[model samples]
Target: MNARNAIDMTAPVQAPRDAAPASTWHSQMPDDKAMLRAAAELTRDIAVARPGIYWPDMLASAFVGYAALAGAILVSHPVAAVLLGLLSALALYRALLFIHELTHIHKDALPGFRMGWNLLVGIPMLIPSFMYEGVHTQHHARTRYGTVEDPEYLPLALMKPWSLPVFALTAILLPVALLVRSAVLVPLGAVIPPLRTLVWERASALAINPQYRRRRPEGDFARMVFWQEVGCSVWAIAVLAASFAWGWCPLLIALCVVSLTAFLNQVRTLVAHLWENDGEAMTVTAQYLDSVNVPPPARFSGLWAPVGLRYHALHHLLPSLPYHSLSEAHRRISQHLGEASTYRKASYPGLAPLLMRLARSTMTAR
Candidate 1:
């Protein structure tokens, strides 16, 4: 999706004075199908036509070595432990970037490269990269329809004006949220039957559906999730074993699990679309609901926002483009989309502001 010039702040910027902002133009819903079709033209190589050891890839290699060193430092120096926590946070962020792709394409295009990459990247991040592919694939396929399952997205209406209070409460209770992610969500992905059932159900629904059968199911993003998770799980277990032997269980645990959740990945996703007209056909995860491009942490977070994730609208509109080319597509989309695009910038952010905007911004909805 191309981006547009910043809203003319100098202009009155009156949202149609007489008409309801709900006018269909506010629906400015890009012809998602058309965007997907254009993207299809470029999906031929989801990764680079030739994957080279670029700077990010090299940084990825350095990270693994850093993790190994982190284990030792965590026991020897408390400051090192905290610093490792930050580093782990950074690594987990990158892991999610791997997931963005895992959500987009299967890893079989270049198995040798993919397998090694997944093992190297997924393990330290504790993502179970392989398993994520399958589950996340299903997520993209049935996002809003049946997989109404992923609800970092609760209807703001349900919360009412109280939503603000609730969001405030949540900000303080964030540790609880992180606890749920680590103790519950991640573990369930590893051990529970019900969670696996969710994955299978999502997969089955997509398998039988027409629109979803777009890319081959096996090679779909689901597989990418599955393998990445697989690798992450293995690495996590290994980290535990090694740490236990080194008598650094607590430290290693913090590095592998606690810090992973602290990466704020879930926040990035949840706030992206937390409060929208949940009644309308939502894009599966509220993650697709509302998002902005060129957010605050662009340069620092670029590696973590794979496939032009900062270009959320574009990424959602055209998931097939190689991560590198998303910028070009986003540029084009901007010119065509103009102000039809929403959230001209990252004005209001975090769950609370987003919820407030959702309520006020209902100025319009499709």
Candidate 2:
């Protein structure tokens, strides 16, 4: 039997603060290199993807999302429009989750997937995958994972409760912000070299923390960023022109899709980690605990955390492992290491309890 199927997989009990200090959570855990080597050996056979399994699901998700959005716009009934909008949001959010995969999966390994996602989802959404490439790698780096340098890892536990609303509200306004960045900022940066350098370092990154500035891209990578930004600029202008010609309803519908997608992604990011690190460089074990894994038997987790992100701690352990292979990696690690392992401790019960825990912490801190 698969290790994941062996037992009822509820959230593992969190270790007490004294027993598991913030700085030393991984002290008793297995060596990172050895653990990964063992996991790699166990999952070697299952890591590779069958194109048949990969392509169809991705294409289907993209198609369904766009079709649902169209249904929202064309459907005359008010009830049908709201339902279609909700469905479109969920579907597009799932498709957008593929952006996380693009950060880990090499272009050569899944050539079709890379191009397909960019054309079908990225360009249309105005969030091209290239923006994430260099930035996401920093989040996976050993020393960088919980640090200020890690753009994706915000220490939400340290922030005031009021700031949480601001964090979430930013997502709702992301549609307008991204449009302005692409349509206006990108073009201005193109003509002015100094401004282009500043924009490349500051604005081009898709980062969670405002303080995490990006380095300038060079040569081939710079060219990739240039083209992707240009594509988004053109798309933004076209969207504006279409809205002007066809009227406000179409623009309103587009905003609904983008806004909902961004909001859902923000919520996922909130639950992705404990947000416990306080600018400290966490140990491998500490980092895993600081992160989260919403394990199986919780079926609804898949809807909120599509693309294997529910196994986020596992992804941290094996950043090179593809999304489709994360469950197997978790199983192998669980089977080899057993129930009380640090790996098991990272698993959470559900989103509500997790969010409640974070809220309680925020209150206590205040």
TM-score of each: 0.59, 0.91
The lDDT for every candidate, in the order shown, is: 0.44, 0.77
In model 2, how large is the Cα lDDT of residue 310?
89
TM-score of 1: 0.59
Worst 10 residues of 1 by lDDT: 1-10
Query: How far out, in Å, is residue 166 in model 2?
Result: 2.1
Which residue runs of candidate 1 sit more than 4 Å off their true CA positions? Answer: 1-50, 53-65, 68-77, 106-108, 138-244, 249-253, 256-263, 282-289, 295-307, 336-366
Candidate 1 lDDT tens digits, 1-366: 011123332122234322433223223433344444544554444435235533365357447545744563556776776666566655555544554564464354434654554555545544334434444444344334222443223444334554434443443333333334434455575578766555444432212222342222465555655555455445555655676787775544454544444334544453443244343444321233344455442353354343356566455545545566666665554455454433232222223343345555333332
Error at 189, model 1, angstroms? 12
- The lDDT leader among the candidates is 2
lDDT of 2 at 44: 76
